[model samples]
Target: MQLENKVAVVTGASSGMGHAIVELFAREGAKVVAVARRKERLEELVASLADAPGEVAAYPGDVSSREVNEGMIDFAQKTFGGFDVLVNNAGIMDDMSPVGDATDEKYEQVMAVNVYGPLAAMRAAVNAFKASGTKGSIVNVASVGGMRSCAGAVYCASKAALISLTKNTAYMYMADGIRTNCIAPGGI
Candidate 1:
């Protein structure tokens, strides 16, 4: 088990890639905190993984909220006794509207989920890692829209910001053995 004895926080964990990632982590013997807005879905996921080598706990909340982001990390440490991994996977797609057609509200909403949430979580995780003296790891889910103009303007820009944040975090914390990475997936 590559992740044996590790404790991880996985956001967007109610469905899709987040759900799959949580399964993989638990299968590898990591205690995982599955986070999402859908409480019932998170409960179902936890129940389904009942016999895995590790464990999964549900933390239902909106990742767009800074408090929620930080709270999930704290939950990982308190529940599992240690914190080692952070997977920032919660996100939402824009309405495929160009900048000229997008609303201020849409921009704020997308950016809050795609970028700000991860930022706050990363900040909280780094502090936890430093305090615990654990060399932690972080994974940010970016998109090809970040590198290309394939998606709506708001989405593309938000993803681009995440990608940059990932790079900056990796560079800033390398000396502390806190590694960070991002995956720029094209599509499901």
Candidate 2:
């Protein structure tokens, strides 16, 4: 129970790496607030964690929305007392296309989910951490595609922006006992 009595909010918890992180956090004994757009899948994930030391609750909403991020954090604070960690893992990858051929829709879609989503979540989490006066940790999931240029221009740029955001947030909140870090997975 490394995380006994701790509460964490994990975005993108409906699938992929997000799902794995949520499961691991629950196993570590942190009550998890799982956020994702797919309500059914979130419910299934919660059901699967029935025996975990920590409980899993679902908040189905678009992570790109500021309102949703704030609401999720407020809900977690009310439900579990306060938040000690945030896993900013929600993201999306648009169809691969060269810069010249990329559609505005595709770019917007990628930025909205992959960039703005995490920004909103981080903002809400940092405020909560400061208000609670707790030492908190933020783990953002990025990609080396941002570093190596394998992903399309827009997608790569979005992740690179996230990397910068992580660093800046870490620096800004260090004095308040908040730590922020990111993992940039390479290749597929």
Clash number for every model?
0, 0
RMSD of each predicted structure: 0.5, 1.0
Tell me the tens digit of each residue's lDDT in model 1 across 1-188: 99999999999999999999999999999999999999999999999999999999999999889899889999998999999999999999999999899999999999999999999999999999999999999999999999999989999999999999999999999999999999999888
Question: Pick by lDDT: which candidate is best?
Answer: 1
**What TM-score, over all chains together, does every model reach?**
0.99, 0.97
Model 1 residue 89 CA deviation (Å) reads 0.7
For candidate 2, the 10 contiguous residues with the lowest summed lDDT are: 92-101
| Residue-by-residue lDDT tens digits, candidate 2, 39-62 | 999999999999999889999999
Candidate 2 residue pairs in clash (backbone atoms < 3 Å): none
